[model samples]
Target chain A: MHAPADPAPLPGDRRHPGWIAWALLAPMVFWLAAFVVVPAAILLVYSFCERDEVGGVVFRFTLENYQRVFDPVYLRIFARSIGYAALTTAICVVVGYPVAYTIARASEVWRHRLLLLVMVPFWTSFLIRTYAWITILKQEGLLNGFLQAMHAGGGPFNLLYTPAAVVIGLVYAYLPFMILPIYGSAEKLDNSLIEAAYDLGAGPVRAFSAVIVPLTMPGIAAGTLLVFVPAIGMFAITDLMGGAKVPMIGNVIQNQFLQARNWPFGAALGVVFMLMFVVTYGLLQRRGARLAG
Target chain B: MIEIRGVTKRFGSFTAVDNLSLSVRAGEFLTLLGPSGCGKTTLLRLLAGFEMPDEGVILLDGQDVSHLPPYRRSVNQVFQSYALFPHLSVRDNVGFGLRMQNVPAPEAAARVAEALEMVSLREQADRLPHQLSGGQRQRVALARAIVCRPKVLLLDEPLSALDAKLRHNMQLELKHLQRRLGLTFVFVTHDQEEALTMSDRIAIIHRGRIEQLGAAGEIYHRPRTPFAADFIGQANLLQVAVVGRNGTTARVRVGGGLELTVASAELPAGARTALVSIRPEKICISKQRLDTENLFEATIEEEIFQGATDQLRLVTTQGTRLHALVANESAMQEAFHEGDRVYCGLHLDDLVIVQAE
Candidate 1:
């Protein structure tokens, strides 16, 4: 056995033994090891196991669950879910950017009031808010009733239980996520830089595109990640507003556990879903770094 | 040439710039010198079209540009922070204004290269603003503003951020650049030394009005107002009562009943109560009473050695405090100590009669 040379300690670490530091970190370490690491290890192990006939774990190793996760039916559902999430991110950006910019540029009094308004939706339960949207958007809801009352020449249109309704719900739920981050970036932007641009002969449109957009890009990237990742895995809005008519990846993964009682397949799907997130996030980080450089 | 007439800019109840008027001659380096919140920066912003004057007309080459936006005006400003785009390279930052004018790529590139060469930053053109040192960034800002060849350039204390030594060097370089380009330069700064070194004419502003506007020597030696006298350089403002007037000069009695002669053309007509402004350097000190037009005996209260000169605080026999600066030359090797009796002499040409206000 060989003893390694002791490196110099940090500035304030000389008085305390190394074990004291570990003892101080024990609670956080235990919580992560118990909740996160242990669950991930279990999921990885179950992903390769087989299920018994009575919907219990057989404890036998197999690759069949992983193979079933790549079937055409489930792959299409994953693609549809990604497409919807991308569209929701785009819509949120388009609608939230101007609102965030306005709030950031407003006077201090108005800025705080407007920020409070943006966060008011978070005070209530998200499920209750989605249910409220249902009443306003359904076929016989307030919109259709108002249209019928005006004696319009068309029948009540099917507004809910569609892709448009799903997108609307996702955008509404995730808009504040977009606004808050972008506002943070916009608020810290130096006004003198804009004035410098105009003084250098750039018009208003040119200044906004050249100076403003590139400066606020970090916030846009952060907001996109905040809205896109969870939206792909969302099941509540699809079930309520989308009527669950079209199968999404979330709907299928949720059904595998509850209705089919296929725990191994569900574990496999979850592992694959987590892997997709890792890859997507890795790509976005690379792109963000490149843009910054 | 730029001319501002009756410019009054008010922000709500506070008037930042009062009814002020100034004419910047062609190719002249005029500095707006004042302390903070004296509306010197507001006047610069007005010329840059960042702020519209409440009542005034700004004429560039005899054409009204008061209502024109900053982009539309043929003027550029070098902000105090440099305001260089952090994401862009030095070359791109310098070439931004030309690109805005729809200049062709090759021409804009050549102009950018020339401007960079002028500032001696050709090698670091590919680096961003953050990568450059403070002085290098300031030069880039200068290059950026001058590359467009605007009729006028407004600089709002652009050299205040640098260290003292670098600021002195940049001041010389900026003066050389301004003279070579022959563009009207309107600079704003509270530093009197910088104003005296770089400006052809200095406009001392105070409380939203121009107290005095003239060449550096005139403003320093003969300030018409007390504010200008105190703001420009160190001055001993002695309260005096006018005894009589004598053809462009006035005889005034100091607090100690001593009479002195000073130039009085700037003083208000028939003014009895007046103030006499005298430069500290003008008063000479000696061990014996020297033969001079105005002589006074005082006790040296304190002596501050400042390498090249010694600032002596003297209290006259009548209890009037006065400051006299003596050169630390070899001929005057005998140093004056505190509480020593000394004779201070003031020349006739060194004093100016100013308004009591």
Candidate 2:
């Protein structure tokens, strides 16, 4: 008796959006403007200012702090920080990938339990956890005592207060972050694609490099950035574990603000760090987009 | 050429593929057609060396390939999702297999170009897979699979993701490509229409067994099992009584006292049980109500106009229902009106008698 009803439930074609979309997006715009955009603007302004006698930032215009950031003392420190972060990131990828892949391909019941295990360590405060590491790795700490109980010849290996200890701590802290995103990407990887690669005359190594690695690149990129960027600016680990022996860029910047009493120099360093983030993020985004396209 | 001998795959306790045996002649176009969960895809993977059968042997060109790893086999598969490298342009994706084989650079480029031309995608070689439409991506996948020219090509529902019109075009294009290249194809799909339209031979699978394997016409017209008859086409399966038999032919008494003969190898000697099947189009409908030897009176319960043809569901005088399909039904008017009296005839040769149980 009546004509058939229209099947399409959505009102407008996606090509043309309506006012409701803009309304829904308002809150996101407000959040980004309040936190991210405003902070970046303040940092930019502080970068161009001069420091007063008491380390309070003065509004007087000056490019002196920016010029001083290029000094050899600071540049060498910056390079060392980058080198350490890069090494930590590389280690995390090599160590985290197999664990993540195993967890992803596991049975359903075990997968949830395994994911919980990965997340459990994060419930405790990160600083407290770092302190716990100091207790374990320090001289006459659990590791050294245990080594001595085993009748080890060397009195105690100076395992703590070294660059290696800093890396170990960083790798331990950020490993789960590296694992989770790569796990997501690897879990969604279609199994047939791997079979196709193998069917087309690719050896196991070739299939992994050509198909699996490329397919899961987004996760690898995400994990790399997650570990590397944070490791670069981690002043706490350097102070606690590196025994304040190594002067990383992060330590230098922190000293400028609180110890050295040079707020403008610290502001300049913060701005440079933020700019480095932008460059690294832009390059990674382009690479991911190229792969997806 | 590929041969699967008594291959069986079991997942824990449940069997995915029963002990199945079939062969693919060189340059033959074969399809494994079935419903979902019917194990056709499992069989394809076995042939591709992705899964090792629990008990069986696979031979390619008279050599035992059962123990060979997937990479060592001279075969390639076009995955249902296309599996185009998201990181690579179309040219690189298509050229991947050739590169793996260590072919010379110029030869690989030439072969990739030839393969791309075959799919009419040479112009889009520089574009990524996502940059192309779904149909174009499908052709790109086909080009990638064919570039290696392996001994066998396995396709797992390759065109199923495309829209209706594009699917039709791709079906024809795939058949043409298969013939031109003379490559053995082992396609898997649940679409019976696609199987009938494109395949030189169809292995109708059900559950974990191959119910029947023959040419398309043979499988459609001379269905060996009730499942095959119901799956391949619309059949008016009416309960009937086998009144008599003579050599290869048998006379069956259907509902409403209609009698028909069918050529079948086996039929129990009894008038109590049998199912006589006839294609909907095999029934002749008339409005004038003439008396014929093979006649049945009915009333039209529903009539549906299907553009080119009208389908009528009728109830007989004895309250038994039957469906009839009329081609170009616009001009053939009258008794197709709802509740109008009609008489129909069933072609004797078209009648197929299957076991009732």
Candidate 3:
């Protein structure tokens, strides 16, 4: 992991009061404690507790909730969730890299305009945007209408409630995350190094693979984390796009809390999902570190 | 091995490399020496095929490679920033060219090892670029470029980033390597001392044109233009009007009253006014009367104690101000101070008339 981006210390700054540093750090510490640490602690406690018949939690400790998380039914959902997230991440990379690189290499005025276009979708609510996709992919939607108007073979395909629709929604929602980070990396890449590669007898393909790709790997890694971790836990897109037919791990956990009213089991599933994210993140960080080394 | 014929490159409205033609002899260390933005780097880029010329043909070993890309041409460049691949190990960086060329794996490895050995960076071959210091990184850049074994190697101020001691050592090492490999090197630098020390022939560039190109000693002692004379070393330029023309030397009037004779070989034809270049170190200041033909009495206006010499600023009686650098040995004996009158002698051979800029 990179070091925190603290500003360089000015000379003779040690004479300031000791409380100043604490004052500067107070807000961030309070935010993490209140939102991140407190929620995780509550989840951990609830994962070990038993739930009552009416969805109320019991004070007695038990291992039943944890045992339920390891069952084959949830494990299969977990594997499918990982599969969909990985597929989404791979598709995002293949589609986003060229767009990011083009924007990074564009002229200064055009670069900012293009980046603004990339972020314009975030101005609207995410659920509204997902609804917009549902409109486009549903039967008699704009896409099918266009296809029918063109007299294309195969009438009104059932594309709205499929696994492909879910993957498409996931990729569309998280593609900008991939683009922004890779653009940051590509913009900072030195031009002369590319020239040096060409000067050393590398063609366009070889120079890109040997020089440009490696130089921008950090941004690619960061983008992967940003898209992959959250994608695995996303429930709304899978529910709306898959019509709740294909229950991912996220859909299962959501069902446990609301439809099934098993609060302790949902807490156990949430804790396990959080652990998977931590493990995946750790593995990615290790790979990034080795690549850099 | 390379010939640049009337190459002209323009960026938008600004002409970077003007209609300039130059030729590089095979197996010679030719340096493009000038201050920054004088189009020296542009010329090097043109020869390396990084930037195509707008109006000329670049022939590499009798082949017209002007329109070809850098990879198709047999030329490599060591960039000013070193440009070492930060993500790759030194070995991989050096082997990048061979890999691109589809060289066999075992042969590529041996050549990479040989290149690393040449740079004496064998131990650091497996380390990434950031793991090495500036000098080692510089050597890695050198090895990476040379491993391709190109017909010409373009070095764009490759030593500018190193510390003084390391830069000096690298200069010697580079010259030795060039000789050992018998490869043509077209190096560029703004440092005159570095140019004088490392170049087999220095092309003194000014305003996208070569002001003078010759051997180091020749360019230093016999500069053809006023810019060449002043840029190579410290020279006191005197504006003089041509008074009379002799067989080979011409009598010129300095300022208003002082008169001197200088060789007119380098002077532009039919020029009524010319600039004479007098190297300060060649100016002799003596307390005793000297028998030189071009001798004048001058008062010392200022004296600066340099480490090896005393820099004396003198104003002639006829209102010609001149700077003289006298050896510390004689300067100590004479102990010339400000306001002291002294005799300044200018040898006829030392006074050269050069073309005005």
Instruction: Put down candidate 2 lDDT per residue, A60-171, tens digits, no spaces.
Output: 8999999999999899999999999999999999999998988888988999999999999989998899999998998878999999999999868888999899999889
Ten contiguous residues minimizing lDDT sum, candidate 2 chain B:
B263-272
Return the clash pairs for model 3, or none: none
lDDT of 1 at A164: 92
Q: Model 1 off-target regions past 4 Å?
A: A1-31, B246-249, B264-269
Off by over 4 Å in 2: A1-59, A150-155, B246-249, B255-257, B268-272, B287-293, B329-335
Worst 10-residue lDDT window for candidate 1 chain A reads A1-10
Instruction: Encode model 3's per-residue lDDT on A32-138: one tens digit a residue.
Output: 99999999999899899998888998978999999999999889999999999999999999999999999999999999999999999999999999999999999
How good is the docking of model 1, by CAPRI class? acceptable
Model 3 off-target regions past 4 Å? A1-19, B267-270, B330-333
**How many clashing residue pairs, candidate 3?**
0
Q: Evaluate every candidate with DockQ and list the scores.
A: 0.33, 0.38, 0.44
Residue by residue across B1-357, what tens digits does model 3's lDDT show?
Answer: 888899899999988888888999999999999999899999998888888989989999999999899999988999999988888899999998899888999999999999998988888888888877788888889999999998999999999998897888889999999999999999999999999998999999888888899999999988888889999889999998888878777888988589997776765568798888999999888888899868889999999999788899999999888888987785338678899998888888898777643
Question: Could you tell me which 10 consecutive residues in candidate 3 chain A have the lowest summed lDDT?
Answer: A1-10
